[model samples]
Target: MEDIRIRYYSKTGNTKKIAEYIANELNLKALSIDQNDYNSPCGLLFLGGAPYANIMSSKLREYANNLIKENVKAVALFTTSNWSRRTVRALKKILREKNILVYDEFLYVHMLAVNGAIEKTKLFVKNILEKYKG
Candidate 1:
């Protein structure tokens, strides 16, 4: 309900589902990174993506690099992966370069094939509210 924006680069729909779950639960629209819908000043930006073969995608990096601290106060990173948390670290690094505040708490639900993604996202969103009342 805050001026939060959700953007994700999901190649296999796994990360997209995570974004959708969070958006639906939080009443925000989940947008693909290419949508380029980030315009207004944002209190928090929820950027989602998954590592591709253990590395972060170029497209995700490009978008993150362009994030301005003047527009985004903070970022909440999320990713869907089977054996990696690399995406979170990679995004964090990009955000730091721009001097954007990255939340100490992040969301990393296991790949959707394991089920309970909606439940997991619900809990994640609940924690976000507790930490960031923005």
Candidate 2:
């Protein structure tokens, strides 16, 4: 089994908390999207962020645009928004241009508490593990 990494972009720490919770649940390393090494040999990634001004975070948007030679095969996008699907749509469009498949399990927490994030992450991870493991 190849390693799956968790990467996120956050400003008010909401996305960071969700990312960390997911990473802990899956026992995977969580890195800031800015700090992710494009050369790393990861099978898939859980990319997360919080919407800023109703758009994807600038740094994360840039990172997704710049992805070229990475070994990542797929991504599961997670986000926290008041109630907008535009973030996922924007990210999906970007990833489509790069030819990276976005997993069907794209998750978004509607501005949740830390414990809420953890619980949601647990359910998401469980489904992902089952899909990949099966």
Candidate 3:
């Protein structure tokens, strides 16, 4: 099996936490978009970012747009937000336009200005993992 790649950009670390969970579950390396080399070989890709003012972090958005993979079989998207707004929806639209196959997507509610409750976040991540792993 090819390795899965998990990349994320986060300011408040909520998205980073979720990305870590996904990466750990998939046995992939969790890296920040700013720190990783995007040219690495991988079978799957997971992109995550925090929703900023109802939009994805500009850095993450640009990174996703600039990804130069020719045949990505599976892609997963995740974002953290204070409310259930259109953050993930916008990300999905962007990825669709880029012709990436988004297999699953999730939006997690995070407390504003804080890293959020770790216990709650863990539960949410567990639920997501269970759902996707099935």
Candidate 4:
């Protein structure tokens, strides 16, 4: 089996936590999007970023635009947000345009500009992992 690679760009660490969980559960390497080179062998690529001001981090978007993957089977997206679909939709569009097969997408409620919901976010992440693991 080709190695799974999980990469993420996070501002407040929420998306990073989710990425770490997915990587650890899949026994794949977890790396910051900026720190890793995309030329490496990757069977499945999981991308994550935190939603900021109703948008995904610019850094993450730029990285995604630059990534060139051949035959990516499954792509997973995760984001931490208060309440905004714009970022997720934008990301989905970008991935689709790239012809990357997105296996699943997830959003975790965050405590930015609102009450912190760390526990809820954790449960959501766990559920996502469990569902995708099947």
Candidate 5:
């Protein structure tokens, strides 16, 4: 995984499931942002969270802010929402302020079936790989 880390905060388990799928598929470590040692790794970071009222959870925001003092090379974000980019923009603002490079974003809306979410995540992963592939 080369220091790639997947961290997420889930309120209803949906975001957690998405994070786990991405981590497992990519053979990387998946952890909760609340973990005691959830520091930004060196290579890449995948941060996920559930949006509430068009805003990211406080835990995610705090972690993003903390990245300013870390040495992470790049970051990507994934979220489970009902169709809003406000959360993404808000978090991007924080990362941008710290001059962190945001590679891409994935948004998986809450669906009744798991297949839809899984497929979307797979596509998101593919896109990320293609975008970052050099």
Candidate 6:
């Protein structure tokens, strides 16, 4: 598998939980946006966030905007929200604007109810791993 990095911006920890789960399965540390730097290259980047009123945080937008295509090859998005998958869509748009490939599929977890988050995340991660494992 190629080196993968997981980063997220979470206001209520719901997104964080999902990010952590993805990282744990891949044996990597889940990094908050504040902790992650874009100085290094990675094969795939898993970015997670939640939007308020369908508005993505400026910080997260900036991160997506500054993502160097040479450094981060591609992105897979995920979100945790009450009912909106807006963040995932927003991130995809931002990344694609810069010509970065955004995986067609994304993960979403209900913010208030994550009863099967791990299992769902496992399946998501499995598919991601398989795709990149080559």
Estimate the Cα RMSD of every predicted model relative to the unseen true structure. Answer: 1.7, 1.9, 3.7, 3.9, 2.2, 1.5
Regions more than 4 Å wrong, model 1: 112-114
Q: What is the TM-score of each candidate against the true structure?
A: 0.91, 0.88, 0.72, 0.73, 0.84, 0.93
Candidate 6 worst ten-residue window by lDDT: 125-134
Clashes of 2: 0
Judged by TM-score, which candidate is best?
A: 6
Q: Which stretches of candidate 3 lie over 4 Å from their true place?
A: 69-71, 107-109, 112-134
List the lowest-lDDT window of 10 residues for candidate 5. 106-115
Flag clash pairs in model 2: none
**Residue-level lDDT tens digits of model 6 in 27-111:** 9989998864876888899998998887988889888888878888778899988889988888898889878888888998988
For model 4, residues 29-134, the per-residue Cα lDDT tens digits are 6689887566665666777776677777778888777666474555667666666656667777887888876655465545362235445545644665555566
Top candidate (lDDT): 6
* lDDT by residue for model 2 (8-84), tens: 89888887888888888877678898785766767778888777778887888887787653677777888887787
Number of the candidate with higher TM-score, 1 or 5: 1
Spell out the clash pairs found in candidate 3.
none
Q: Which ten residues in a row have the lowest lDDT in candidate 1?
A: 112-121
Model 1 TM-score is 0.91
lDDT of 5 by residue, 54-120 (tens): 7788888888788753677777788776666666677778888888888756555563444467778
Task: Show model 2 residue runs off by greater than 4 Å.
Answer: none
**lDDT of model 5, residue 10:** 83
